[model samples]
Target: MPKTIIPFGPQHPVLPEPLHFSLTVEDEIVQEAIPGFGYVHRGLEKLCEIKDIHKMIQVVERVCGICSKIHALCYCEGIEQMMGVEVPPRAKYLRTIWSELHRMHSHLLWLGLFADSFGFESLFYHFWRIREKILDINEKTAGNRIIVSVNILGGVKRDLSTEDQKWILAELKEIENKLEEVKDTLFKDYTISKRTKGKGILSAEEALYLGAVGPVLRASGVAQDCRQLQYAAFSELDFEPVIAQEGDSFARMQVRYFELFQSIDLIRQALSKIPEGPISVKVKGYPEGENVFRVEQPRGEVFYYFKANGSKFLDRLRIRTPTFANVPALAKMLTGIELADVPVVILSIDPCISCTER
Candidate 1:
């Protein structure tokens, strides 16, 4: 069969970010896929040199809108470590609640987009509609929906009052019930399973070899999660990384679906055990050393490295986003799959080109 070169994205309806993949296909089966970047690349990392560490937190938060809090949290934790500042216990618990809520919002966004990729319009609408509730929660607690600049260097900028905590728990209960109602349609529906199951297989070996992270890695049966590092308040709460063995597109989706519930449970647990105290602490000096922090993003593990020279500005800052690590695995998964399945397969990784290109 003659081979054909097809461009998959940069502006494809299914892609939420600008990721261009040139797929070589013969008889609809992809023979090879070459990914190209830079369309939406923002040189945010380079800005650390000009922006003070305090201001850089805001810049880092913009790395990806969906996972903004995680990015800011990781950056703050690294800076705090270098400065020898310990976050308050109450702040730690608050971080966990917001982090889990961030995860929930991100997964819901991806779930809707993934469904839309495969032509499940109803599922897409349903997921996004429920996600609006999460956005409302963000606004009520953090004062903004998308960026939610609540994380600061010493700790958090916002506090959940008694009334606020009660409201959050009530909202989470409603979200949980809605998630249960949609579980069957998302996982067991013929349309979803038929297209996703047994498609875009990424064996455990390939996933690890390619450095895949997040739901992509978890779906491959890897129990690795940065949250297991017990950062923030995760140690205080009961937590477990969701794992799936199939390593297919459906498995990836399933992992995220189940994780939505897990995140909800985590928020509930954190709120119940939250200690009442100051939400932030005072930092006496500038960050003077090097430290690394990792957090479990909705996509996967996100790493932030910060090096300081006892100055207000950072000496070096580096970030390794999950999508960047998962690209090689995405290329591997795309090979040998039907071209028509490419969109679903790509969505399975929940690729965030902005995060990758940042």
Candidate 2:
């Protein structure tokens, strides 16, 4: 078979992010992949330099809509550390509730996309219909569905009333039941298995060597989870990372499904035990230092660095998203797989290009 190189990104239909990869293919088998980026680069760090701390929170939230609150939480954690402020226990638990809520929605959203990738239109639509519940809860609780600006300097910008908590829990329970139903279908569906099982396989060692994280690593039989670090109220809760040994597109899907259920459990636990108190503290003094913070996003670990010089604006701000780290692993994993599986493999990372770029 004569080799033919086809560019597979930067604005391609298969890739949600603006990534460019030249795939050298012969009869559908990808012989080689050359990856390139730099598209959608917006100099977010420069914006941090000009935007004040309050304004910059919105900027950071824009880093990724799927993991927006996690961005705010991580950025706030770094600032809180620098300021020597311990967030209220109640606030910590509430933050976890919000974070896990986002995670559940995000993972479910990815599941729908993956289902669509395999031409399962009914599954995709069902998943989206289920996801709207979480979005409704987000809007009712956080006052915004997508870009929720709930996190502030010392705590959250919003509060939950007793009635609100009750309503939220009821909604969450509905979500959990529906998700369980979906999970069962995904696990046993013949077509889903046919399309995903044994496709886009990544060896355990190869995954670790390629610096894979999140579901990609979990699907490869790795048990490592950043959430175990328990940076926030996670320490106060009980949860485990989801994993699978198949290391194929199927395993990736399995990990996501398990994680969605786990997130529901986490939210329930948080709501049950959440204490009542103020959500924020007063940050009177200007930050005069540098710091780094990280959080477990739905995709994976996200890191943000900030430098301040006792001014209204930060001297610098930088973010390293999970997608940036996962891209290399994607390239390595795609090397020997048939081109037909590329979309499933790509969706497995749940790639958030906006997050990676900003």
Candidate 3:
């Protein structure tokens, strides 16, 4: 069979971010894939030199809107580590709540986008509509929707009021109900399973060796999660990473779909046990050392490194997003699959190139 070179992404409508992949196919099976970057460069690295450590929290959050809080959290944690600041117990729990809330909405958003990509219009609309509740709750709590910017150097910038706590719990319960309905629909609906099941296969070894993390790694039967580090309140909450053994596209989707419910459950648990106290701590002296930290973002593990020189401005700042680590795995998975299935496979990795390239 003759080989044909086909390009996908960086400008396609189905993709939420710019990621270009050149696939080599023969007789409808992907033979090889060459992925490239440097398309949407924003000079984010250089900006670290100019922006003060405090001011750059907003900049870090903008690395990706869907996981902005996690990004900010990662940045703050790294800085906190360097400064040797121990955040209050209450602040850690609040971080967990917001992080899980982020995971819930992000998964739902991805579910809608995945459905829309396959022409499942009704499923897409319904999922997105259900996601608005989480967004509304976030706006009510943090005064913003996408980039909540609620993370600070020592702890968090926002607090949940008594009334807000009641409302949030009520909202989470409602979202859980909706997720149950959606879960039933997903499992019963043949169209969705038929399109998604057994589409992309990545074995457990390949996932581990290629640096896959979060749902993608979990889907491949590895329970690897940075959350086990217990950097946040996750240590206090009884914890177990979700996993699926099939290692197929459907498994990936199912892992995320089920995690939505788990996140809802987690939020409720956090609220019930949460302690009342100050949401943030004051940081006066400048950090004088460098530290590295990792956090579980909506998609996967995100890395943040910060260096301070006893001044307000950062001496250096850096990040490594999950998408970058997953790219090599994506190339391996795309091989031997039909060209048409490329989009679903890409979505399965949940690539956030904007964050990756930043």
**Top TM-score hit:** 1
lDDT of 2 by residue, 1-358 (tens): 8999988878976566687889999999998988777897787878876778888888888888888989888988888887788888888988998998898889888989888887888998999999899899889989989787898888887888889888988887787788777777888989888878887788899888888778888889999788898877999899878889989888888888888879878888888889878888888776879898877888888877878898878888888898887888888878888898887777777788887777
Of the two candidates 2 and 3, the one with more favorable TM-score, higher being better, is 3
The local distance difference test score of model 1 is: 0.90
> Tens digit of lDDT per residue, candidate 3, span 207-245?
989998788899999988888898878887776788899
Among these predictions, the greatest lDDT belongs to: 1
Alpha-carbon lDDT, every model = 0.90, 0.84, 0.86
- The lDDT ranking, best first, is 1, 3, 2
Compared to the true structure, candidate 2 yields what TM-score?
Answer: 0.96
Residue range 1-358, candidate 1, lDDT tens digits: 9999998878888886778999999999999999999998888898989999889989999999989999998988888877779899999998888888999999999999999989999999999999999999999999999898998889998888899889988898899899989988876789888899999999999899889998999999999989989889998788788999999998998899999989888888898899988999987778777788888899999988878898888888999999999999999999999988999999889999899999
Residue 16, candidate 1: Cα error in Å is: 2.2
How far out, in Å, is residue 61 in model 3? Answer: 0.3
Clash tally for model 1: 1
All candidates' TM-scores?
0.98, 0.96, 0.97
User: In model 2, which range of ten residues has the least summed lDDT?
Assistant: 12-21
